[model samples]
Target: MLGFIDSADSHLMSTRSCGACSLHSSHRHALEEIRKVPISKRQILCLIALAYGNFCVAACVSLQAPFFPAECDNKGVSSQVYGLIFGIYELVILTASPIFGKMFAYVSPNFFLESGLFLAGITTVLFGILDRIADSLQFTVLAFSLRIFEGAGAAAFLTSCYTIMPLEFPDHISFLFALLETFFGLGLIVGPTVGGALFEVGGYITPFAVLGTCMILGSLVSIILLPKSGGVTQSKSPSVFAFLCDIGTLLDVLTIAGCLNLIGFNAATLEHHLRQFNLSPTKIGSIFIITGSVYALTNPLWGKLGEYKFDARWMSILGTAINIVGLLFMGPADFLPIEPQLWLVIVSLIIVGIGMAAKQVSAYIACLNDTINRRGYPNETSTYALVSATNFSSCSAGAFLGPSVGGYLLGTIGYRASTQVILGFEILTLILLVLYKLCGS
Candidate 1:
């Protein structure tokens, strides 16, 4: 009787194994068929909605940077308080993404996308008119409140889009994702200039009002156009914790965090550092433009490389090396005899931007693929959501840390020394990538 039971259990286990293998094979064949076909009109519409959503959310996030600080000063808010106001948005995003990601088993991605857009749009418009509040305390409270809500909305919208893209464009995941990221970068590039101009014309309220209204309109359109998909099999789906358990996936997440940390570090400190040049605000904005433009333009190239089956780990290492060179020249390092020159700064910013695009895009693809291929997660929407949530959470954490740490280091240790700390981070990332490669091989 015991021998008969063992034989039955063995047969059951083999049957399950065969079923899993067949499912994976079917998924692979479906993807190959998708690759062979032309993109449908529905796919085009979905892409448009996703792209515009990315642009709107990014623009709204950045547009306030140009004028908000001065407004806070005028309202008697201290630099520390106002800076937290900026950092708090990312904090909220970091907190909210995982919840939405976990909800993927129950909620549709389209619902999150549309609702997030609506919520974000409304909060943005409400933020515009905070100038009417007379008391400093009241203004500050409302400012923080509005930003918190805005952050939540943006997190939802971004997480859903990341989830949706892999499902909608499985064949062109890397390239299409890169293209969407390019739009995001463009929005970042355009936001400050547009905000500055609009502020000049109509003060604090105008930029937010206009951008927010447009975003709301965009959200409404997405409701009609975005593709609809059902949730995944909850029984088979792994938790976000499960996904992160894979060492390679965890390192990829860290790589993403490190990349964004450099970006946020620059955003907080670079303008202040450029003050030494006695350049006007307009000129400073132009210098800032250099990095965004380069990053945006070069992303698709990296994405193409990803589609070509480039080894993401090696790409990350190469990109990190380039970023180190950029940072070395960015401060003209203390060891170097040369003074920091504008021309050299320009060149360094460009190099940093290119490296950033490479590192960021490759890390994203690596995380997604590693989760599916090596980690044995299903190639389904739930896995996508979990990966997207993890990546976005890392991004928010990095963004939040970057400015806070950058500002503290800039104040305490001064600019060049602060950059050395950041350089150390990149070097550490490089070392890890090389080790990951060596170990995997």
Candidate 2:
């Protein structure tokens, strides 16, 4: 997987006479590189199948946010218990993703991909079944177990997808990563909308049933359509321990992950805060759509930018700065002296989305570049696996922490103050970025 880095070829921004011309030239160069890579018809089919599978996996990850709380209340579940049920999925992912990532060293990627989908499908069905059971310790335990099971599946599916892309499209790593994330973002955008609509029409069970069936179909596609294996050798793989302990790389993970935590922090509270205005569910949901749409739409653009114009570190830092401005505008809309317009919130969310897309894509590229530089090649499975796992793990940690921390602050001090938590985190990240840049210079 290790390819020689051509310094002139790798730095896309240096290729042209002017800024706009540079962007266009780099884009054309990217297209030309992609065109040079000859992917077989079967490879195309498999990539599509994997993409679809990732979509379903992402949808399942988010489907419960809208309906689960109401259902838990109806079943007499406590707020703490409900929150636990909600967070446990990510908690499981945080712990399990690394293990699954490492397993790719010994197991076939196809095996993990197919088996994970099947397990996720089964667990989704089980989660729906929990809806029928009387609320009790048994019910709560079963629910937690099912969510953990699904999380394991999610971890496996994502690890496999992330690993496959770099291996399969080694020449177009940034573009392919961006493309895959676009699908993932699309699923997240649609999941709540579709799940809520299904819940309204067919009750609590329908969304999981429909989405779970999709997973089963994805599993079949993985088994039948995708290749069985493109084996990565293990003899020269990096120690997972060493990779985790490296301070420089670990700092990158912390910086990106910490910024992501703030994004999650604001997002987790968006619907709740919007409802303070007595807005209709449809109106509130539309706000989410705007944010998600922006994230989905700009993901590929950011990917292209990282691949062409600048080093991903610069992108990540700039992304963090932009996100801070957006986050400041987001919450305590009620606290503003003027009556808050919906337009303001919408614009803020869009900005947030753009910043998130930049950070997430660039961070991944930065990590991959760092890994390649350290290892003298990009083909090291354990190195990629560890990096990928750390990415997912940190994101999951943020997802879990965001709601808990944000909700706690909201309850204790009120909405305006709750946002300060996010502000503090982002400010800290900005300072770190500046310090790192100065020190590197």
Candidate 3:
């Protein structure tokens, strides 16, 4: 279990321990001092900006869900092509995150945060007008290009925000992280509803145009309210490769990827599945809300558990188990001898949402703690940036893989069999996690 750290060069470990001891002492002192004071006005303003940013980015990501596939179908594009377009955003994010992570020391987080919001907002507005291109090929190309740029902007925004949070509130890292995620969850909850309603009112362009303008305005406000420093101090940071080399850390990262894969799978295919109900866009969007609502409500509980020093591995294991059960019912499996029902889908989504929140929160905390504690990485902005990049990249990878794979499978084998394939992947992840725990003992 500790083999990765144990196998490192003894000399290097001794050097790292000395450096880390001093860093940890200083870090702890700073946090203790911060706790003694009331939350500063600056911190409050920063939190508001960060929370709003999270909300906007998430809303943009999910906003397309209710209408995108049908719109693509109308344009003569196939499910496979549209799925790849969706996956491409995460692909870009995965590629861009490590590059931004390495630059954290040289650049101010405020620059990344504000610029990212602006870029994403602009691209979103551009995307709104893509329907004007009547040619199928042109529409596809523009869609892909805009999504790619938007993904890069999202990557920068997320990475910088992650780094900023730990620096600003080291004492409440997990809680604050969870709190921001709650806002993200809220964005997910709201995106489809608003998008569906706006799409009904003004067709394809309205949701993007309206939401994109809000993001642009939000960026301008963030520039004014966010602190100039971003709490970054120049320091040597460990490479992203260093974190990947550790077995424990790698496992936690894999857990994040697997969990997100399930999410991406649903995002890509669930709208199609619900077509059988012949629901309106607004109702379809409301169905999408079930999972996000559960996730938003449950995230704080998981974060509080992490803040109180609960065993994260156990939380992960339990979450995985719950997720598997949800998936089993989600498909009603080929073996269950039951037909799909609206109530069943809702129940399964609620369960999956709870499980996802638990896994996500615990995995992040586990990765961060394992790096700083067991691996002896320093508690500083550089380390925070690297960790943020690694985890977000994992999520991007899963998000990319899930839709690309799920779409192909959905087109080829249909929804029921496709869900079973996802179930198999989750089972594999569960087995690996259990084996790791048992072997470590």
Candidate 4:
């Protein structure tokens, strides 16, 4: 009895000696961390700036989408030039992503991010002024050139912001990432809506000018408050080239998300599908509302899950499964052997949105975890740069490819058949993911 009491006293004296207590303490610490929110004014300012920057980047990407063709027509340029202008923007972003990522070795991410914002602002101003040019060839040339520059700026901005995120909010990295994505998604939708309104109010120049001013203002705020350096020191950073050469480390799931985005966007347009139903324009628009709302609502939830060390692979698998089910149900809602209800279309899209959120959030967290845990880097700017670059490039490529390929398939093979093509691609992605999981385990 004396010996047992002595042992209990010793255990009480040294908490670490009690394995169960140690575990409970560790778990308590983790829970405390998860519950803790950012409290610093600097953190709040930085997050606001980052979120706004994401919004601006997405907005800029889509702003010209609606008005470019009309503007080209006004300048007497061929409609083909319109596509070139948009294509050039995305192409430049794709190529510059890695280049800017490499630059982080020599320069601070803040410099790249701020400079990119400035560049985007200046290019937007140039776009507004280019409308004054009366000559078609000159107008086309200058506009395309400006857009290319804007793309470079966008690449720098995106890379820097994402790289800085984990650094700034190390404790809540996944949550922050989700928030950034949410703002970006909103920006994509808002840009065109606001741009159209501005066009109606004051034509092409007005939207550009208004948005440019806002960007410049945001840049100034960032310059004042943004960190002068990236999250990790350059001295501790790995060589970008070395990282890229290690192709095994690259997140293949990102490429899948990119492909999914392509299919998802094409599905969102739903012009041909809706035509089959003979729905009114209002009804067609409501279909988009359903999908978009679900996507936006669930983004933050996925982000929180990622932050909590949720198994991204499992999340992705679940997401992909849901996506496949959605795609299968989208086929011939009216003409199928057993006529599918219109509500199935809505149900499938909601499931697809949830799946997309899971895949996107989980894939990002997986890559981030791989970099931090597997590679064991102290400062992860280069790794994050590559991650951000891969994401931007893949999504951009998918956006460009989805419409082009999906359109061709739809035109040639019809809606039901084109869906099969998309389904096949998704299935391929799922198979690869499963293999990846097996290898990882």
lDDT of 3: 0.76
TM-score of each: 0.77, 0.79, 0.84, 0.66
Q: What local distance difference test score does each model get? A: 0.73, 0.66, 0.76, 0.62
Model 3 lDDT, residue 165, Cα: 74
- Model 2 spans > 4 angstroms off: 1-30, 76-81, 129-139, 164-175, 230-232, 239-250, 266-268, 278-283, 300-314, 333-342, 365-389, 410-415
- Pitting candidate 2 against candidate 3, the one with the higher TM-score is 3
Q: Which lDDT tens digits does candidate 1 get at residues 1-441?
A: 000011111111111224444221222243444467778999999999998988888888877665565577679866556656777788988888768877988889889899999999999999999888889999999999998999889888877887788678756553465467667767787777786677777877998999998789879989999977987334444666666777788788788787767766766667657767886444565676676678767765775676565787788888889899999989877777879888998999999989987887777767766766776776555565466557766777787777668767776776787888999999988998898899862
**Candidate 2: worst-modelled 10 consecutive residues by lDDT:** 1-10
lDDT of 3 by residue, 1-441 (tens): 000111111111122224544221232233444466567888899999998988898888889888888878788877788888888988988888767866887888889989999999999989899778888999999999999999988888887887787677645553465467667767777889999999989988999999988788779988988887743555666876766997778778888887768877877788888888788899888888887677767866775665565677778888888898999888678778889887898899999989887887677667766777778877655676567557766778888988888778878887778889988877877887788778862
Q: What lDDT score goes with residue 233 in model 2?
A: 48
Model 4 pairs in collision: none
TM-score of 4: 0.66
Clashing pairs in 1: none
Query: How many clashes in each structure?
Result: 0, 2, 0, 0
Candidate 4 wrong stretches, greater than 4 Å: 1-44, 65-87, 125-143, 163-175, 200-205, 227-251, 259-292, 300-314, 325-351, 365-393, 396-400, 403-420, 434-441
> What's the CA error at residue 126 for candidate 4, in Å?
4.4
Give the number of the best model, judged by lDDT: 3
The regions of model 1 sitting more than 4 angstroms off are 1-47, 70-80, 102-111, 130-139, 162-179, 223-235, 276-283, 303-311, 331-340, 365-387, 435-441
Task: Please give the lDDT score for candidate 1.
Answer: 0.73
**TM-score rank order:** 3, 2, 1, 4
lDDT for position 60 in model 3: 88
